[model samples]
Target: MNSLFHDRVRGLNQAPLRPHAQYVLYWSQMNRRVSGNHALAHAISLANSLKLPLLVYEALTCTYRQANRRLHTFILEGVPETAKRLAALGAGYVFYLRARKSDSNNTLYRLAENAAALITDDYPTFIAAQHNSSVPAKLSIPYLAVDSSCVIPMNRFEKREYAAYTIRPKVHRLLPEYLKPWDMPVLRQRWNLPLPAFHTEVTAGNIDALVASCEIDHSVAPSLTFRGGALEAEKRLAVFLDRNLRRYSTDRNHPAAHATSNLSPYLHFGMISALDVALAVERHGLENNLSSAEFLEEMIVRRELAFNFARYAGRQTECLSSLPDWARRTLLAHATDERKPCYSREQFERALTHDDIWNATQKELLLRGKMHGYYRMYWGKKIIEWSPTCQDALETMIYLHDKYALDGRDPNTYTGILWCFGLHDRPWGERSIFGQIRFMSYDGMKRKTDSAAYLREIAWLESTGCEPHPLQ
Candidate 1:
C-alpha cells in the first residue's frame, strides 16, 4: 500500500525539492475549521518534520462563478472564527485576504512566495478543483491536496461506484481503521517567522459592509436565517444529536420535522469535518442502536459514495450524455413523452410552476439554503420531467442547485442530480417522462409522508422571514 501522505496528498507525485521555503502553507479553501481536520493535522505533521511553522491562509475572492448571496454569506460565517481558532493553535500566521477586483492574483502570489509547501482542501467539483490544478503548475514549491470532507476520503475508492450497496461494504470494511478519532496534534515548537498583519477584519459585523462595497450581483441577498460559521455549525450538530438524531430513521423523511442534521452548509464550507460528526454520533452511544446505524449508513456510506463518483468520473456536470449507458438509453426513450404541465427553467426558478408542492420545495431551498433530504430527490426528478429535454433539465437543476443550495456544487449535489438520471440508483418500473430513470412526484411524496404538514411548514418559512431570490 502507498503511504497515506504519498497517495492522499497532492503534488507528491513530483520529485523531492530543496528545502528553501520557510513555512508549510495551508491554503484554506474547502475545509475551514480547526477541529477534526485531517488536512490541518497533516500540515502540522509536515511542518514539524521540517522544523518550520505552519501558515494558514484563506482568500475570499468575488471572482468565482455564480458566487452570490447564499455562497458568500455561508463562506464568510466561518472565516473570522476559523482565523481565531488557528491563532490559538500557535500557527505561525493566519491571514484572510479580501479580494476586490484588483487584488486577487496578488494575494495568491504573496502567499505562494512565503510558503515551503502548499496544502489545500481536495474538492473535485466547482472552481476549487480548477484552483488546485492550476496552482501547482505555476508554483515552485510542492502543492498537496488533502481530503478532509468525506468520512471515507474520496481517494479510498479507485473507481466510480455503481451504487450505495456496492460501496457500503467497502466503506464499512475500512471504518475501523479510518473512522477512529484523530488525535489533535500539539505544535512542538513555534517558528519565529514574522506574522503578516491583516489589513482588514472580515468578521460577521463587516459582512454587509464588504458585500455592499463589492461588485457582486445584488439580486440574491443573503438569507437572514442560515448564516455560516464554526460556532453555528457546532450548535446545529448538538441540536441534531440531542433532539433529532434518535428519531432520524423515522422522522428524517418528514419535511415538516426538523429531524435532519442541518450540517450541509458547514460541510460545504469545511467548517466541520464529516469524521467529527460521525465521532459525535458514535460517542452518543448510537453504535448498537438500529436507528443510529441506519443514520450512519446515510451519513457515511451514501454520502461518501457521492464523493467517490465526482473524484473518479469527470462528467459530473454534463447532461444525460454523462450518465451510464443504461441511464442515457432510458432517458432517450422518454424524450417525447406527453406531459400535462411541462415548465421551462425560468418558470421553475421563479416558482411559477403549477404544482404547489414542487414550488414549495423550491421556495424552501431559496429561503433556507437547504431542503429536506427526501424532498430534494423529488425536487430534482420533477425538474427532469418538466423541462423540454433531459439535457435542459440536468443543466437547469445544476444551475439552480449550485447557485442557491448551501451544499450546492459538492459531490453530493452532483450525485443527487445524477441520481435523477439513474446514477447510483436502481431502475424503477417503466414510466413516461423518466423512463427507467427514478420517478418522484407529488403522489409518491404524499404517500411517503405528511404532504400537508410539509406544505404548511414551507408556507410559514416563506411568509415570515427573508424573501427567496435566485442567485443572479
Candidate 2:
C-alpha cells in the first residue's frame, strides 16, 4: 500500500491493450505538474516497459459549468511551462484547447486511437471525476486513474473518517513511511512522433488572445494577484519558507498580517504537490528553529480528510445529506428560527450586508479570486446568518466559489463550507438562528484580530484595482 507506487494506481476498466499501438497516452487532468507526479511517473514506467514513446495529452474545454475568462486564463497560463517540462523529460506533449461547444469534443478519443494504455489523474470532484467514471469503458486500452493529488494517496483510508481527530493519529502514523521525497522516473525512449492535429501550442504572450478565442464567458477577469503554473507555484513556496513560516502559527488567524503562505490556488491546481511542499517546509523549519507542525497538519491531515470524505461520499459531496445525523438534526431544528434580517443571494454576492468585515471578505473574493482563510470562516458564518435559510447559504457559498474562487470546487472548499453547518464538528451551545452549531460572533473577530487593518488593505485594493501584494 505504498502511496507513490502501489496503492496510488487504481484500475478502472477491464480492457486489453490496443494491438500494435504507436505510443502510450498520459492524460493530465488535475495533477498537472511534471515533477513530484506519481501518475506521470507511472505513465513513463509503463511506456518504458512496453518499449514505446509516451504522448502526454492535456486539454482545456470551455464547456464546463461557469466556464469563464478567469478560469480559462489561469489554466492557459500553466500550459507553456508544462510543454517545456514534458519536452525536457523526453515525452511528447499535445495540448488540446476546445474553444467552443462546436469544437470537436472527441480529442481524447482521437488521441487514444493509437495508444497502448490510457493513464489519467484520479480526482474526486469536477470534470475529472466524471471523465474517470465514463471514459474508461469507451477505451480499448487499459485505463488507470492514479492518485497523485494526496501526500498520502487517498486509497490508504479504508472508510470515511468522522473528523480530523479520528484521522490525525492514523495519518501521522503513516506519515513516516510516505512522507519522503520522490523524483520522477527517467524515460528510456524519447517521444519523436508528430503531434496530433488538435494540438495547440501555448505561449506567454498569447495567453489572453487564446483565452479570448474560447467561447467561455468573457466578463469575469483573471485574478488580480495570483498567477498559475508550476514555476509560479515553486516561487511562492520558496518565498513562504523564507519569510512567513515562522509567523504561521502565531498570526495565521489574522487577515492583514500576510503571515501565511498564499499557496492555496497553486495547491488546488496541482501545480505544487503537497509532498514537495511538506518536505521543504520541514527542512526549513528544522534549520531555522521554527515549528512547521501547524502548517503540516492543515496541509496533510485536514486536507486529506477532505479527500477521504469526497472519495467516500461520491455525488453527495455538495449535498447537505453528506452531513452527520447530529448536524442534520441541529440544522433542521433551527431552520425556521431566523427573523432579524434575511438577504437574497444577490445581496450576498454584491457584498451588501451590514457588516463591513464580511463585505470586505467578499470583496477580496471578487477582486482577488480568493479570500483570507481566517475571514473565510466569518464569510461563511455570516452567510448562514443573513441568508433566508441554511440551504440558501450553502448554495450561495458554492455558487460564489464555482464562479470566482481560484481554489473553489475542491474537496477542501466543500468541506470547509459544510463545517459552517456543523459537519465534522460537535454540537455547541444553542442560539437563535444557529441552533447547536458553533457560532462566530462579530465581536469575537474584532476582539481577536485587528479588523480595521484588513478593511483598509481591502479598501486600497478595491480602489486601486489591484492587490496590496501583487506577484508582479
Candidate 3:
C-alpha cells in the first residue's frame, strides 16, 4: 500500500491474504460514498498490487438497535447512486437488505470466503465501532480498518483530547498535509463476475417499497425535509457554499437563520465525506475572500475532538462515568435537587413538555431528523433540569436521538448530548438542578436567539408537513 495512506490504515488481524483468492473485498460498513474514501482507495491499491478484481459489499439489516423506516429509507436511497459509481469504476457492487431478523446474517463471512484481504471503515461509534472490534478476529483473512471519516485521521491523536482548545492547534499544524484532495487510484483489473444472489437491487423508485417491506419499526416516517444519497448531499453542500458560507460564521447559532449546512445526517451516514466538505468550503472561502475558520473549527477541531473522545472513552462514551471528575462530582452533588414539573420519558418523546422552546426542538428532530446546534444545547439542558434524575435525563436524550435524529448514534450525537452533563466542558456558577454544569434557561434562549421565529417555523412544519421557507 502507498505510504500516503499509512496513518489512515490499521491492520486489525494477523492472518495472511488467501493465496488463491479471486478478488479483494471492501466492506462498506461506514464511509459509504465512492468519492473521497481513503478505505476504498486503499482497497483499490491493494487489489491492483495483487492483480485481482475488487468487490464492494454493503448491507442494511433490521437487526441494529433502532432499525426503522426513517433509517432504512435514508440508507436504501443512497444505494442506487453507490451502485452506479462503483460500476463505473469497474468494481463489483452488492447491497444486501436483511429486512427480517430471521434473514441470513452471514453475508460478510460468506463474501470473505473468497476474499484476498478484507477492508472496512474505522469508525469510533455506533454499529461500525462494535463491528470493527469483534469482526476482525473472526475473519480468516487480514481485516484492515481505515480512518476515512475525519479530515485529520483519528489515529494521529494517541489519547482522548480534553477539549476543542487542546486539539485545535494540533489539527491546524497538520491540516496542510492532510486536508488536500484524495486522488482515488484507478483499478487495474475490472470485475466481470455476476453479483451474488443475496444482492438486493435498490433504485430511486423502489426505496419506499423496500423500506415498507422491511419488518422494522413502521411508525417513524422518513424526514419531511432531508433525503438520502450522495447527489442530495452534494446539492446541499453546493447550496451552503453559494448562499450560506459567508453567513455561517455570523448566524450558525441562530436556528431560524438557516445559515448552517444541514449536512450532519450526510456526514453521519458517510454519504458525504468531511474531507470533501472541508476542502470545498476552504476553496470557496479563499476565492470569495470569506473566512472559513469558524466552519472549519466545527468541522475539524471540535468534530474530531468528539471522535477522539469516542476513541478513548470506548463503551463509556455514552455513559456519565466517562465525564470528567468535576462534572461527575458536581452532578452527583446535585442529584437530589428537585425538578419542578418533572417529566417522564413518554412526555419528552411526545413533545408534551410545557416549555415551548424545548418542545419546538423536539418537534424539529421529529420533522427534520435533526435540531439546530444552538437550540439542541438548550434542549438538552432543559431536559437535565426537568427529568427526575440526571441519569433519566441522559437516557431521554440518547433514546430520542436513537429513535428520531438522523444523526443519532454518532460520535457527535454522544458528545453533544453528554455536553449537557458537562463532558468536555468546565464548571459554571453553582445552580439548582444543574449545579456547576452550565445551565440554559428559557429566558436566556429568548434573549440570545430568534426563539419566536424558530417556534413559528416548527409550528408550520408540524401543521403542514413541509418546510416553511425555501432557505431551510
Candidate 4:
C-alpha cells in the first residue's frame, strides 16, 4: 500500500514520528465531524501505514480564554455523534473529556500513553492553536497538526492576502487537485490491544447537560433558534441549496428576503466542512446560474479569505492598529469629525438608542445568533461613527460580535470588523466621523435597500421572543 502519511499544514503541521510508537492518535479540536474530514483521513492513513489502530480523543477544557457557554455547547453537541461514527468505522476508541481539573490532566496523559503518533486540528486565532502548539512539547510521542478547515490550506498563502479577488484565482488554480472528495479508508485489520482501564474523568454529556454544569460565563446564553450539530448543519445546507440559492445573487443583500445560507454557525462549529457544501452545490448543477456563482463566491472565496487573514496576520484580535499603514493613516485623519448623534457601547449592546433599523439588527444578532450580511456591514460601520474614538469603536464592535453572533470570534468576524477601518477596502473621499475609511450609514442603507421590509423582519423576530443575550 502507498504510505498513508503526507505533510499538510492547515494552521500548523503534524509532527515527525519517532521510531518506537503504538497507535495513531487524532486529538480532535476544530474539525469535529467524521464525514468529509481531511484531518481524520490523514490520521487514518498514518495508522494504516504504521499497522496500528486509530484513537480519537477530544478534551473539553474550560481554562482557555473566552470558553463561554455558546462555544462549549456547540462543541459538546458533536462528541457522542462522532464517537458513534468512529466505532462504526472500526476505529480504536473515542473519548470525550469534559472540563474538570482532575479529568483534563488524566485525558492528556491517557492520549500520550496510547498514542504512537498524534494528529490534531489546526486553528490559528483561538485557544485551539495554543493547545496544539503547547501539548506537543510536553509529550514524548510525535504530534502532527493537520490543516482541514480551509479549502486551500492556510500556509499556501505565506502572507496575508489583500482581498478575495487576489486569493480567488490562486485557490481556483489549486481546487482541481485538492477539491476531490475524500474516500473513507476501509480498516483492513483490527488490533486486539487491551482497552485501557483508566476511567475517563470527563463526563460524556449532551450540550444542555454540559452547559448547565459549566462554570463559564452564562451572561450570553445559547440562542433558542440556533442549535449546533452535523445533522442540523446538513439540513440547513439542503434548504439553502434547494431554495435560497436560486435568488441568492439578487436577494442576499435584502435582510427581509431570507435568501442567504444560514449555515455559518454550523461552519463555525466545524460540524460541516466547506468541501462538503461545495460538492453539494456542484451536484445541483447550478454553476451556470449567476446566483449560484455568487453564493459560491461568498462560501469558497470570501469565507476562505477571512481564514487566510487570521492565519497569516499576527495578533488577529488587535483592531485597526494592526491594519496596513495606508488604512491606518486614512482612519486617523477622519477620527475627530463631529457626529450628529453618538451612542455608547452599553446603548448598542442593549439594543437601545434610536434608528429602529440598527436596533433591529442588534436584536436579531442577539436572538437568532446571526445577522443579515447587509446589516452586518452597516452595523460595524455605525460603531466607527458612534464611539468616542475609532479604537473604542473597534473594541466595542469586537466585543458585541464575539459575545452575541454565533459566527462571531471567527476569521470572518475579525475581517468584517476591520472592514470598517478600510482593510481590504479602498479609501473614499474624506468625511467627518469616517475620514477616508469607507462609510456605511443608516440613511445609506435606507436608500439602497427596502428599509421597511428589513424593519418588519426585525419586528417579527421580536414578536417571536428570540433573545440573543440575557435580560440585563
Candidate 5:
C-alpha cells in the first residue's frame, strides 16, 4: 500500500487475505467516482500485490429510509460515467439495482466469495456507515474501508473536534502533505472475469425509467438544478472556478448571487472527491492571483470538522444528546418556552410558514435539492423558532433533509442542522426560544442579504422549474 494512503486504509476485520481468490473487490458504497479515489487506488494496490484483477461493485437498493425518486435518480445518473471510467482502468464493474424488496440482496456476498480482500468506503453517515459496521463481520475475506471522502482522512484526528477553529489549523498544517493530485496506479491484471447475472445496465437514456421502476417514494422528484455523475460534478467545479471563485469570498453568503459552489450534493454523494476539488481550487487560485482561503475554509476545514464530529459521535450524530453542554443546558432551559405559532412537520415540509424567507428557503430545498449555505442557517433557526420543542425542531430538520435535500443525511447535514441547535457552536447572549443558542430573525436576513432577489429567483424556479441563471 502507498504510504500516502496508509492512514486512509483500515482493515475492519481480521480475516486474512484469501490465498486462491480470483479478484480484489472494491465496493463502491459512498465514494462512487474513479478519479481522486483513495479507496479505489488502495484496491488496485492490493490487486497488484496479489497479482489479481479488481472488480468494482456498486449498488442502489430501495431499502434505505426515504428511498425516493430524487435520491435514486441522482445516484443512477452517475452510473454510465462510472462504468466508462472503470472499464478504461481495466477493472470490472458490477452495478446492482435492487428495485424491490423481493430482489436478491446477496449480490455483495456472492461477489465476495471469490475475492482476495473486500475494500469499501469509510463514510460515517447514512447506509454506508451501517454497512461498514455490519458487513465486515459477515464476510469470510478481509474487510477494509478507505476514507476517500475527506481531503485529510478522518483517522488523523484522534477525537471529535468541537468546532472549525480547532480543526482549521490542523487541516491547514497537513494540507501540503495530502493536497496533491492523486497519481492513479496502473492495474497489473485486467478484469477478465464475467459479471454477475444481477448486474443492471445503466445509461443516460434509461435513468428515468430505472428510477421509476424502483419501489421508492415517487412524489419527491429529482433535483431540477443539479444532475449527478463525475462529469457533472467536474463541470460544476469548472463553473465555480471560472465564474464564481472570484466572487465567492464577497458573495457566497448571498443566495441570489449564485457565487457558492453548489457542489454539496456532489460532495455528499461522492461523485467528486474533496481532495480533487480542493486541489483544483488551490491551483486555480494560485494561477489567477485570487484568494481561495474562504472557500478552502468551508470545503476543507468546516467540512472535515463535520466528518470528525460524525466519526466520534457515532449513532448519536443526529440526536440532540450529541450537543455540547452549554447547548443542551440552554435548549433544555427554554424547552417549555411557548412558540408563538407552532407548525407541524408536514406544514414545514409544505413550505407554509408565515415567513417569506423561510418558505423560500424550503422551496429552494424542494426545487434545487439544496439551499444556500448562508441562508440554511436562517432556515434552521426559523425551524427552531416555529417548532413546539427543540427536539421537535431537530427531528423536523433531519426528516426534511433526509427526505428532500440532495445534501441531506451527510455529516454536514447533521452538523449544520445541529448547529442550528448549537452543536459545535458557542453560546450567545440570552434569547427567548433559543435560550443562549444563536438566533436569526427575518429582519436580520432581510437586512444582511439580498432577500428580494433570492425570492424572485426561487419564485422563478417554483413557477418554471428552470434555473434563471445559466451557470446555476
Candidate 6:
C-alpha cells in the first residue's frame, strides 16, 4: 500500500509552480478546522519545502443550493475561531464573503496569483466536489486535493461499498495503520503580506449582520440546538465522554437519554476531525474502564461508509436511480400499491401529519436542524410511507435536508437520506407501498425507543424555544 500522505493527495492539475510566488495557498473547502487536518498539514509541508509562508482561504458564497440563514450562521460561527487559530500559527487567513449575488467570485483566482501551489480538501459531496473538478482546470499552478475527511483515506476503497458489514472488516484492518493523531505543522516562515481587500472580518457580534446582509434566503433560522466551532465541538466531545459514552452502548437509541454526541454539525462542517474525536473516545474508555465500541463503530465505520458511497455516487447521490438492484426491483414490484392518506411535500415540510411522533421528528428537523438518529429513521420511513409516490418521498427527504439540516449536503446526509429508499440496505418482507423495502412502524419505534420521552422533549423545545436537556 502507498503511504497515507501519498494516498490522500490527488493531483488535480499537472501545471508547474510559479517560481516567484510569495506563499503556498491552502483552501479550506470542507475540512475547515485548523488542527488534526491532513490537507492543511500537507499544505504546510509544501510551503516549508518551497521556503514560502502558508495562506489559508475560506469563503461563504450566496450561490449554493439553498443558501439560507441556518447554513450561513453555522459556517460563520466557526470563522472567528478559525481566524484566531490561523493567526497564532503564523499563517495568513483570508475569509472572503460573497454575500450578494453580485459580490466578486474571483477571490480564489486572485489569491492563486500570489501562490506557488494550491491545496484544498478532497471532499466528495456538495460544492467541494464541484470545485475540485472545475477549479483545477482554470488554475495555472499544480492543484492538490487531499483527503482529510476520512481517517483511512477514501481512495483506499476501489469500489463503492454495498453495506456496513461489507466494509467493516476492511476498515478495521486499516484502522491500526491510519487511525492515529496528526501533528499540525509549525510554520517556518510567518505570513507577512498585507490582508487582501476582500478579507471580511468575522466576529460573533457581526455574524448576524453578515448573514442578514447575504442575498440568500432569510426565512430558515439558525439551528436551535447546536452551535458550530472547534471549541463547541470539543465541548460536545467532553460532554459525551463524561456523561454519555458509558451508556452509549445501551441507551443511544433512546433519544431523551441523550447518550449520543451531538457533533454531526461540527463534523459536517469540518470544525472537528474524526481522528481527534476517536482518540478522545478511546482514551476516555481506557481510563474509565468502559467501552467505546459502539461510538467508534458509528463514528468511524458507519460514517466513512457514507463517505465512500458519496465518493463514488457523484451527481446521482441524491437520486432514486442510485438505489441497489434489490431495492429497485422491490419498489418497482409494488409501484401500483394503494396509498393511504398521502401527503404533499409542503405537508411533510410543515410537520403536518396525524402521527405525533413523526410530526415531532419533522419538527426537530425544522426547529433544531437535526433529529435523534433513531427517530430520523422513523421519520424517513414514514415519509416513504405517506408521500404520494416513492419518488416524491425521496424528493421530499432530500429537499427538507438541503433546505434545513445544518449537516445537509454532506456525504453522511446523502447516504442517510438514500438509506430511507433502501440504498445500501437489504429488502424486507413484502409490504404495501414499500413492497420488500424495509418498513418502520410507529409501534416498532415506540417499542425500541423512549418515544414518549422524545415526544415530550421535542414538545418542550417547541413550546419554550429551550431544550430541557441543554448541551451545556
Steric overlap count per candidate: 1, 0, 0, 8, 0, 0
Give all TM-scores, in the order shown.
Answer: 0.93, 0.98, 0.99, 0.90, 0.99, 0.98
Q: Model 2 clash pairs?
A: none
Model 5: per-residue lDDT, tens digit, 166-246?
A: 898899898888888869999989988889999999999999999889899999988998898999999999999999999
Which runs of model 6 end up more than 4 angstroms from their true locations? 1-4
Candidate 3: global Cα-lDDT? 0.93
TM-score, predicted candidate 5 vs. hidden true structure: 0.99
Worst 10 residues of 3 by lDDT: 463-472
CA lDDT scores, all candidates in order:
0.77, 0.90, 0.93, 0.73, 0.93, 0.90
lDDT of 3 by residue, 80-148 (tens): 999999999999999999988889999999999999999999999989999999999999999999999
- lDDT tens per residue, model 6, 1-472: 1244898999999999999999999999998899888888999888988999999999999999999999999999999999999989999999999999998989999999989999999999989999999999999999999998888889999899999999999999999988776577678999999989999999999999999999999999888888888999999999999998999999999988998998898899999998889999998999999998899999999999999999888988878888998888888887888778888898889989999999999999999998889888889999888887888888888899999998888899889988988987887888888888888988888888889988998899899988887783
Stretches of candidate 2 exceeding 4 Å from the true structure: 1-4, 470-472
Per-residue lDDT of 1-472 in model 4, one digit per residue for the tens? Answer: 2222243533233445656666788877777788877778888877888877787766666665566787677667666677677778877665554555454455666756757778788777676757776777777666778777777677677777888779989888877766667676866446456556542323354457667676677777777567677877888888877777777878888877778778888787678998888878766745645345677788888888888888777575455666877888776776677765788889989988677888888888877778889888888887777788888888898788777777877788888888778877787887776767787777789888887987876776678765332210
- Candidate 2 C-alpha lDDT tens digits along 316-372: 999889999988898898888855678888888889988999999999998889999
Which sections of candidate 4 miss by over 4 Å? Answer: 1-7, 10-20, 92-97, 100-106, 189-206, 286-291, 466-472
Ranked by TM-score, the better of candidates 1 and 3 is 3
- Model 5 pairs whose backbones collide: none
- Which candidate, 2 or 4, would have the higher lDDT against the true structure? 2
- The whole-model C-alpha lDDT of candidate 6 against the native structure comes to 0.90
